[model samples]
Target: MTAAPHVPVNLADRLSRFSDLWSQKTVAGVNDYEVKIAKLKGEFVWHRHEDTDELFLVISGRLTIRLRDGDVVLEPGELFVVPRGAEHCPVADEETAILLLEPAGTLNTGDAGGPLTKAAEPLD
Candidate 1:
């Protein structure tokens, strides 16, 4: 076995490689967590992670994390963590770029699996 190369990841460059909405692209990994990126627009399914928290960091545009209680709005360079088991729906009025930090293999659709579910593939 060999160690993976340590290198800097350019978020903008990685984001540019993909144009699909709601699809996650894995950019890097740390321990048991994966650093992923996605472009979001409109609304996403309401879902919850049963075992791990989900972190969403807005890279560009605006993101509204709709919770059962209310909504958490994030601007560029801002981030929010949705606690485990808490249901959330992410929405964006325009094309929004975001970075996600979660456990490896965590599903994008969480507890609500459907057509929008996407496995995070490595960026190319």
Candidate 2:
């Protein structure tokens, strides 16, 4: 059997290239899952996708996931999962870069409001 083509992503390079809040690119995928890199700043919209759970991995800086019940802050090399149907909003004090892994078609913003409503942008 042959191996799939593999490429190493320079996380620092990607972060430096994209400074916009919530700019994403699709890296790779298989079946129903996909990997994405997103640069986030300020506060994101409050919303949730009922069909899929989202995984947030902090690549640099820090990220805070705000929820109705509580919130979680993720530092570099840290990660968290916001389960399906849970209301959440992501916020970064300065600039934050994260790798999001989830099923395809997961919405960036959940069901609430305040801008940031779009499908995941492929960041490869």
lDDT of 1 at 49: 97
- Name the top lDDT candidate: 1
Which residues of candidate 1, in runs, are more than 4 Å off? 1-6
Clashing pairs in 1: none
3-96 in candidate 1: lDDT tens per residue?
2566578899888888999999988889989999999999999999999999999999999999999999999999999999999999999999
> Against the hidden reference, what TM-scores do the models get?
0.95, 0.85
- C-alpha lDDT score of every prediction, in listed order: 0.93, 0.79
Error of 2 at 80 (Å): 0.4
Clashing pairs in 2: 25-122, 25-123, 26-122, 26-123, 47-110, 47-111, 48-110, 48-111
How much RMSD separates candidate 2 from the native structure? 3.4
Candidate 2 per-residue lDDT, tens place, 7-84, comes to 566767756666667756667676778788888889877788787889999998899999999999999999999988
